[model samples]
Target: MLNRKSFGFDWGQFITGILFLIAAFVVMRYPLATLKTVTFIFAVVAIIRGIAILAGYSTLRQLTGKLAWVSLLMGIFDLVIGV
Candidate 1:
């Protein structure tokens, strides 16, 4: 039998999603005012996400061997686009 841990709520991801929703709502509410701000925010988010993916390279590699390199490359692309 496969060993599986109990499924549980991930509060951190949930809270982060909620915060992103709130920010999106605020940006949508004042589109004109937040136009540039939203772009900057997205760029920063992309950069952070890229860094996070890169940081988890080892775990990914362990799971998928050579396939994991694709994710690493994607992360690098994201960083470049963000910058």
Candidate 2:
């Protein structure tokens, strides 16, 4: 079943691919800057994940018994590492 109305160029993918190529060039030209950028992105993600885990603590507590406190600890750890 070839749907004639369902085919078109993926502009979003094209733009993303182009942007990635440019980013690769920049990274190659400036390794230190790239490292910093990547580090910052990871830290932010980790911090957000930690916060989410902490927020769901009650549910986790019910499921994991005494081990739920570990989520709290990990969340704080994420905030510290992010900062």
Candidate 3:
């Protein structure tokens, strides 16, 4: 009696849960890699955020006055931090 729209099961969450469980097992099996693994994940996140900020520069171009300069500075800072 479960309708597709009302079924509270979110497929994406289910898949993510499974993946997280697998990751936990892997981390447990290789305790020494825990630090390196976490660092690499954070690095990737930072790099992606930096790229997003850089891309927003184009949108800021339409704005006037000091806003443009502020956007440019923020984008550059994000890129430097990521690198």
Worst 10 residues of 1 by lDDT: 10-19
Candidate 2: count the clashes.
Answer: 0
Residue-level lDDT for 83 in candidate 1: 94
What TM-score would each prediction reach against the true structure? 0.71, 0.59, 0.49
Give the alpha-carbon lDDT of every model.
0.75, 0.72, 0.62
Model 1 spans with C-alpha error above 4 angstroms: 1-19
Report the C-alpha lDDT of model 1 over 5-40, residue by residue, as the tens digit.
775675534554765776698788987867676677
The candidate maximizing lDDT is: 1
Question: Following a full C-alpha superposition, what root-mean-square deviation does model 3 have from the true structure?
Answer: 9.7
Task: Give the winner by lDDT: 1 or 2.
Answer: 1
* Pairs with steric clashes in candidate 1: none
Write one digit per residue (lDDT tens) for candidate 3, span 37-67.
Answer: 6555445545555566567667656645557
- Candidate 1's C-alpha lDDT? 0.75
Give me the runs in candidate 2 sitting further than 4 Å from their true place. 1-32
